[model samples]
Target: MPAIVEETVQPCPECGSEIRGDGRFTLWCAACDWNVDPSEPQPDAGRLERAGRVLARRHGEQLLGEMLDGSGGRPRRDVSAVAATVLALAVHAVTVVLAVGGLWCVVALGGGIGVVAGVVLLALAWLLAPRPGRLPEGRPVLLRADAPELFALVDEVAGAVGTRSVDAIVVDGSINAAVTSYGIRGRRLLVLGMPLWEILTPEERIALLGHELAHYANGDIRNGLVVGSAVRSLTVWHHIVQPLPHATGLEMIVNALYVLPRLLIGGWLILLIRLTSRAGMRAEYLADRLAARTASTPAAAGLMDRLLITEALGVWLRTEANRAALRGPRSTRRATDRAGELWERLTAYAASIPEHEYERQRRAGARRGHQVDTTHPPTHLRRACLLAGQSEPAAVALQAHRSDLIAVELAAARTEVARRLLRGVLDD
Candidate 1:
């Protein structure tokens, strides 16, 4: 007699439909159009399997190389790290020399206490520097893979590219996705957030995921972490000096003698950060290009456009929330009540503004450019770049909608600036 395999049936989460299971890892949902191996256990099992397959096929060679190279696949020498380190050492050496010279006693006895204060400030800054999060244990997981449609699409793309099965996928609540490395060998991981999945079309999602995979394929994650770690280590000496007490007048004078060398070295450290940020931006563009090449050009362009729009909208919402938070209870209550009443008014006001007017403003800003405010380039510039690469026919359509996207981004940017300014005022 042949052995019998038991079958299982479950209702689809998205729609009310019966789904038959083969007793393997399976996530079958008809309502939201999800179907994949029932045997795969995960929050969104099907999606994970699909993404895993895609990454394995597309980035297998690069991942393998990362594992073999170790040190997170970082180059042996980083000029920025070296320069920062040399500067930090020079600063320390000068401090030591000043301490040994008679200048230290003279300053302690006299009135140059500012040198001591500067050292203290530097120490505190070092101690307060942001620490990088620990790398995930295994490969990063792609979450929410149970949606059958998404899984199938991811699988199709992955199979086309020839990836091995992925380790796992995890979901975050935010509208973001990232590829991370973990463990001694630096296995790859894919993380997706729910908000992003909820908003983007399947093609856009794949493009976003592809962008992350490009990071792995290009060895950006490992190299980035390594470079960051080296930079942190080199700068940590500043923290070492923090516990020292305020210098006397004599000590202050000695410190002044060392200030010139310290300043020269510090300048190099700042240069390193600027250089690294510029390099990182270039890496982002490279990844964007790779994503465009791997996926269809139109899909990549759509993804970029959607991302900018979402970012802009999100920023606006956050800013409004912050403003509301800042108001007194009575004001807040009134604002809440008036929110509904103001909605239509605000909408109408927004509609009255000509679309081209906004685009003109954004373009002008891009041309004039502001000081680098964040690691990433302004959305307007990024969108312009993406639009430039689009084919003529597609570009026409994209340009037509550019105003809408810009409006959303501009609102968000303004909100963010307002919130930051408010926070600064409150802090003061």
Candidate 2:
């Protein structure tokens, strides 16, 4: 057996209490929580965003309660889901009507004014039509040829989650990971944040992949094409009808004429989202369950714990980058070498975080009804759902050697991302 190394214990800078630091996360005093969360709170969101947050919190609480009481299981289509779908179809119907009406006006009316109005109506119809997502520009796209190991791993995870493999893997510097479909064919794209990926253990990385891929298997309504397009169309309608500020005379008249249309469209948008909110929350739970099933419960839970501190991780990266720039320009070989070590230091920083700090964040998340965003359920609920279930063995295991190979494949992209991040700070 290999020798076991002990964690380093030291006194807290804030309070003289013994604290242990591990190779995985930053060490902080359990008693004082000296460096638990050093990032500043974000500014308050807009009224519309706050309203969405409220709805998310409410839905999260309701679903959490149902799960705890054994009332919630697999999400099923209910009346609200049906109503939301109907509303989405209605939006599409309106788009179709506009197109037909525009054609009729140009063909039947046959006048200069009629042609102009028909052209305008046709433009509106085109604008409101459903659009396929596109691949992000200025990012590294990893193909199977370039990253066989990573692609193979993703394929394994997708098979475990009962979904098809993604077409490409895009890597960036942010501390996040997401899966999206792009182009007219809806080819799947998986975006991996290098900062977050560098900090995660191999198993945790698998868990992240499982969770993202599960979103596709789970039929998340909010992310679906029909409803998503409707939402976007409603938003555009609202914007077009919104009254311009400080308008004079004729412009003011135009603004006044659009007032009721704006109100009606805004109301419809809110109602559509509200109707789908519960279903969206349930989809998240279902995805979490699938992730747990694939990656094992413990790994899934660990991934959630890491997510709780993502804000802190982002702040730490920015702070370190700024500090490195302040030290001196990267003109020197030593400075360039130090800049390259940023990812290693970040990984260590994440590993040194104590269990107590995680517990603190978990409790705080529960109290605040913390969510990943307006679209996601509360982090506490998702974690609880994973822990409350029967434990599962990983369906897809990432061996040490394979993990090393994947890392090797990602080395070039990771270096480029790190360089860009450091360059941004250095330029400032």
Candidate 3:
């Protein structure tokens, strides 16, 4: 008889249990088969690759820690430090030269006042700016029971992108979702709105979660925090300058004059904010791509469309609230009845409009060629990208229908202002 050889089984990485081959090319571990890879690679090689991935993850953590804490035994900034020292010296020299010239007295007084004011204003800004501590941290608690499923979808998408697991997910009641990094070690939190949960389907939900996770993975959250902090610090100087005394009313006038300079600097600050914001939006798009790669492009597009619809409804609700408030209190019963009728009509009008029409109207408000808002690219563009292939038209349509159902449910909730008002009255 010819010699027969059988492939040997290896232990699973997650659990140290022996894996057995079932005639098929794939290996199955009786203990846990959470992860599966193609059988083309040798089992030992696969183990090594898994080990390499783990090592890379650890190395990445170490690098992140070093970047944040300036550790890792890296060389200190010798050249940049020297250059900064030289620049400071140059600035001092120029200031001295200007002070000694004909403009010396005014410059000296102005500089002294500006310095004092800047310090005070910076202190105030630090106090007034949104405190890091005040910001929500950790996983946000969701009141809705469907959160775990939502989280699973997020996890699946994040896993596909090789991003770290999210520390927590929170559901705020607002119609917004954001990713924030908090704490010294920089834990990530993904905050989704209640409406979003009610609006997005499982796949679309994954797409949104993927987008937010992308921000965390791409360091957008960290960069945004740093940039926002810097802007707040710089603008605090403006506040301090405004309070300084120059001469009688002249000091105030001089401070007012400084407004232009401050405004100019403010422009730079805004530019930085815009750049960061745009980067964030681009990160969102990239996340959409990742979600598509992980799930399907149509799924991502459907989610994007639903997100836009949710935003529009949210805006309309806010506008309606403002309009209602503007109507003021009704003195007479007739006036109150009339106001109530008008309010009902408005709400009914909003309810009657198809979501797609609302989306179209919102898109029309945008400048030509730009479908998505600058802060957020339009849904149509996202949908177009995802719908590039005709093979999945039915699948895409089904996903769209699912997303539409979610949106309708959420919009209905938002439309129930009377119910909310009734609750408030009952509570009172």
Candidate that scores best on TM-score = 2
Tell me how many clashing residue pairs each candidate has.
41, 9, 5
What would the TM-scores of all predictions be?
A: 0.43, 0.84, 0.48
What's the ranking of the predictions by TM-score, best on top?
Answer: 2, 3, 1
Q: Number of the top candidate by lDDT?
A: 2
| Runs off by more than 4 Å, candidate 1 | 1-170, 221-225, 232-268, 274-278, 310-312, 315-374, 390-428
Residues 129-197 of candidate 1 have per-residue lDDT tens digits of: 334544433222333343333343444444433343233455433446775545555454556543354
Q: How far is candidate 2 from the true structure (C-alpha RMSD, Å)?
A: 5.0
Model 1, global lDDT = 0.45
Whole-model lDDT, model 3:
0.47
lDDT of 3 by residue, 128-243 (tens): 34334233432234323434444444566567666786565554445557777556565666676654554455656666666666655554432445454454544554455444
Model 2 local distance difference test score: 0.80
Error of 2 at 156 (Å): 1.1
Q: Which ten residues in a row are the worst by lDDT in model 3?
A: 419-428
Q: In order, what is each prediction's RMSD in angstroms? A: 21.4, 5.0, 22.0
- After superposition, the stretches of candidate 3 with alpha carbons farther than 4 Å from their true spots are 1-133, 136-153, 221-225, 231-251, 270-281, 315-359, 362-372, 389-428
What is residue 330's positional error in candidate 2, in angstroms?
Answer: 5.7
